[model samples]
Target: MKEKDGISECPEQQVILYVEKEDGKYEAMQTGSYISANYLDDYFLKRGTLEKALGEKIARGEINAIEYYMILEDLTISELAARAGIMKWTVRRHLKPGNFSNISESALKKYSIVFNITVKEIVTRQSGNRN
Candidate 1:
């Protein structure tokens, strides 16, 4: 993933601060500054965790690759279908664990292309439980 230089702020950003006067009284002051969040690492960490969990689930046969892509990969059924060049119903059907083993090699290839992984890797690589 490409690194971003923090968040971009809109032109009308504003902030308020309290100022202490000579009499020890507080006064309100308005200032304009850009606020940015440096959470890219945290975001990637959480996404990695989710990917691991999804891989484990797929390995355990608790969920199929379709479900893993839909949940962990954050893709909608229609989007996945379009990427795979298949119908949404076909994608939904493949989401069933029982139907996963019946997926055609061509369809598997399409899914591998969409996920940017090899067919063998997608089928065999299992991120087993850590413990």
Candidate 2:
């Protein structure tokens, strides 16, 4: 992006951007994130809707904490399995409400680590504790 075209809609949230400067040189510039500035509200709106739907599913016992955290983290089964060092099939099993009970404590710890959450949070599904 050109230096003059750099979006500064959010002064509090500055990001380093490589912008085209005058005299035809590229230079590092401080600017607000284009997507964040332009689309943050829409992102939040969609996120709220998803959260509400997921919360309803959780309340209905159609899914478990494992699945809740997984969806909220935007992780695929294979990606979560890789991060937690668990088998993909096992991760899939844990995503089910009934099958989550069969998971071992060590496995739960692995998932908690992957989610950056406490094991208790994984057990309870009380989310929004990202560090």
Candidate 3:
């Protein structure tokens, strides 16, 4: 029986796959795959939980909009700063709620590109935080 490009070897099995660069063309190429639903589920759950916490922090005058952007992008402070083309210290400073009002539109634009979201979304994420 023939299998589809993204399908597993059997219906009973599921996997996350990547194309392996073998010597053959499309149909003959093999996939490097793994089964890790538990891992993926746990990771997504942690992200959701963390986002909820971050939202509360934003509401409570602890962290700022930067924390939301960073969580959504799954980026570290250094990575976010790098993507924004700014200093890490700048990013750190922006993480505080007190400094958010002073953030420039240009800087928000940079973060918008990194997070693949619009500046409006960054500034005012709605409840449930769905993008």
For this target, which candidate reaches the highest lDDT against the unseen true structure? 2
Tens-digit per-residue lDDT, 1-131, candidate 3: 22344443433345544443343433443433324422556767888898888787777776777787687677999998988898999988888777876889998888788888888887786323322
In the predicted model 3, the residue pairs found to clash are none
Clash pairs (backbone) in predicted model 2: none
Which scores greater on TM-score, model 1 or model 2? 2
lDDT of all predictions, in order shown? 0.69, 0.81, 0.69
How well is each residue in 1-131 modelled by candidate 1, as lDDT tens digits? 11122223334565555656556677665554334233556768899999888778776778876577667667888999999999999888888876877889999899988988887765664333211
Better of 2 and 3 by TM-score: 2
Residue-by-residue lDDT tens digits, candidate 2, 79-122: 99999999898888888777766889999999999989889877
Identify the candidate with maximal TM-score.
Answer: 2
**108, model 1: CA deviation in Å?**
0.4
Clashes per model (N, Cα, C within 3 A) = 0, 0, 0
TM-score of each: 0.61, 0.81, 0.63
State candidate 3's TM-score. 0.63
Q: Which stretches of candidate 3 lie over 4 Å from their true place?
A: 1-39, 126-131
Candidate 3 steric clashes = 0
